[model samples]
Target: MDTRALSVFLSVAETLNFSRSSELLHMSVSAVSRTIQRLEEELGQSLLERDNRRVRLTGAGQEFRTYARHSLDEWQRLRRKLGSDEELAGEVSLYCSVTATYSVLAPILETFRATHPAVEINMHTGDQADGIARVLEGRDDIAVSGRPSQLPQRLRFLPLLESPLVFCAPSADCAVREMVQTVDVSRADFDWKLVPFIVPERGVTKDMLDTWFNNRGVRPRIYAQVAGHEAIVAMVSLGLGVGIAPRLVIEASGMADSISVIAAPRDLGPLTVGLCSLGQRLASPPVKSLWDVAEQTYPRAI
Candidate 1:
């Protein structure tokens, strides 16, 4: 089987758009279509379901995606092993939020690139909450993520820094801000149930927020359940509702000036931010090298 064809298939399988895949792979749309057609013909399977509206992966496509990833990893390993004893050279796929690219990964990537110039870093940015899932699914070799309460047995986490999970309100004069001002939030008797709250839809931050509210015996008035801390901050800045996010993310968000931190009666313990990867992936030189560089970059105890 041609590895190039597998690469093209994986690209299309991920983006689910021929035009986007072609742009990423630097191939023409027709060429990309032909490549997928050849792969389907060879395997006698319909890998993708395409219509004018959108493209979606078939069950076979999902399974083939997993297989293609492993095959590529093995092929890269073989090539490296057979090559001359030079610096490590291959691609390492990484996943993180847009903020993490500069706030968390900048220093580490700077150092890694300096040491391993030949290695390529393919980074994908999305909601920080999805980082762990992406790494576990083998969609990315590593991800910058908050440490989950229960670490998966197959994964390893390297603690880098800690950021307090903070509640924030809009700085602008709005109903939400007025409500916060009318009541002393630091008092134990404050009516949290009356305030509209923007919260994470899922992930560690959401879990922490749930525990915090439950422990306080207050069922929060949830206004919105959204993905990504950045979105939460943006909404809060517009005076939509009060929200919770890591202090690091709030500081990094350009709209920080528009958001005000709320002082709660009790603190939700700081969130530990770190690098996460499958234990097996760390065995790969490129992935391991980046992991090591990150550890050295943030050599502080969590």
Candidate 2:
């Protein structure tokens, strides 16, 4: 079908007035009428019931309206997408938590940036659920997080690292010091039961903490609930509640003078961090290049 004539039919279908449709399309009214006639004849149907006084869609015109609108919208979207693909040569958005910067992920990202001088990498930090939502919605092409409990069908996860969940407390000769050294949360003097404790908002660390208690069937006494790994480390430094965090976080934290890492129990395993991305979306050359780099860097620590 002629695209120009199809456009005319669409405009006339919307306006239900040949003269108005012609004005909007910047075409002569006679040309608009001829286009509509061609469209109707092409489809072998009476598309418009019209005279000089009025115009209206016939059954065929009504049906064709849906297809016409859909086709024209798709064409416009395709044109816009080609323009966007050109712009994509410069930037790639990366989503991760603030704490990830302290781990291998940061080094990998630094290497990626160094190699791809033209590729502007934008980093967005947030909680894990928000990160998952961003990747699932196609907002961020890739996400670094604990593998979601239920991944969407359109996405795939690549396990990257397994970080042990450790118990940490102030090493100031407190009564709780023994409890941490033994890697025992069950002891009465752990102080975490009474003192301040920092926790993630709702990520792998929280799940690890919950599982630690649930597997033993003990209700943990909550002292405080704080957000962010840095904040937790700070709270612990201030002699607040104990903090349970990944080894990477506690190690990178400059406050070793204040808090000490407890030997994590053997029963409690490391949290699995991974990449979440849409399989089809990885088809872009740059996306695939970065994906390969991530897979190479991320798997070694797992």
Candidate 3:
């Protein structure tokens, strides 16, 4: 388990000479001997043959040599990787609600890819809570989530994008298209109507949506409720009732041609979104790279 001892064991095994291994590691010969002795004692077998002139491995030594060599090489690789954590050069895994992937994160990802050309990204799609849970459980390096639940002390949150909620309906014969009429905020130039809706099941953004609708004193038919934005976009494209989603969702769905924006009497208001990860996961280079991209892209803008 002691990597230094493993390193010493591997070195001695490589040259089959204690003196050369000690010289290579810049350690005293006695120290090298004691490390091997301790290793043999731990494994309950003698691992080296010692005479005055020549050194060789005992049968037990040969078997452990393979494991010891591999383990030492792996540990050294880990050290080198951790030491170079300042620059991005590995795969960054992330999770987000389908909408965030298209709306909130597309530009950030594009610029990030351009800047860190050697880095690769793996993205998973899920609901806000699932995204949060994925990152916390080590399934992802970071997650873009609209809601940060009562996270335990081991997790941290990073605020990212804030965009107004918007409703989208099929530009075709969607039922709610007739209800959308643009109004000048100060002048009240057009009319808006209440109808059934598609929304994320009760989370931060959902609560914001509810409050916005309630304050306007309009009752949504409260028909369909689902968890992901893509489904909402898909259903809306099929002429399913109205869907209230974050503005980014509409843009990212790539179905804009199939859907039209439904103007509200007032901006439903910007909902705050952000990134999350386990606090201890910050040391990973991939996480650091993705976090850097997110921070530079969405820095608490006004």
Residues 80-109, candidate 1, lDDT per residue (tens digit)?
Answer: 779857667767889999989999999999
Clash pairs for candidate 1? none
Model with the higher TM-score, candidate 1 or 3: 1
Clashing pairs in 3: none
Worst 10 residues of 1 by lDDT: 262-271
Model 2 accuracy (lDDT, Cα): 0.68
How do the residues 233-266 of candidate 2 rate in per-residue lDDT, one tens digit apiece? 7777666667777676677777767888765766
lDDT of 3: 0.70
How well does each candidate superpose onto the true structure, as a TM-score?
0.89, 0.62, 0.58
Pairs that collide, model 2: 196-241, 197-241
Per-model RMSD to reference:
2.4, 13.2, 14.6
- Candidate 1 lDDT at 287 equals 91
Model 2 residue runs over 4 Å out of place are 1-88, 173-183, 186-196, 299-301
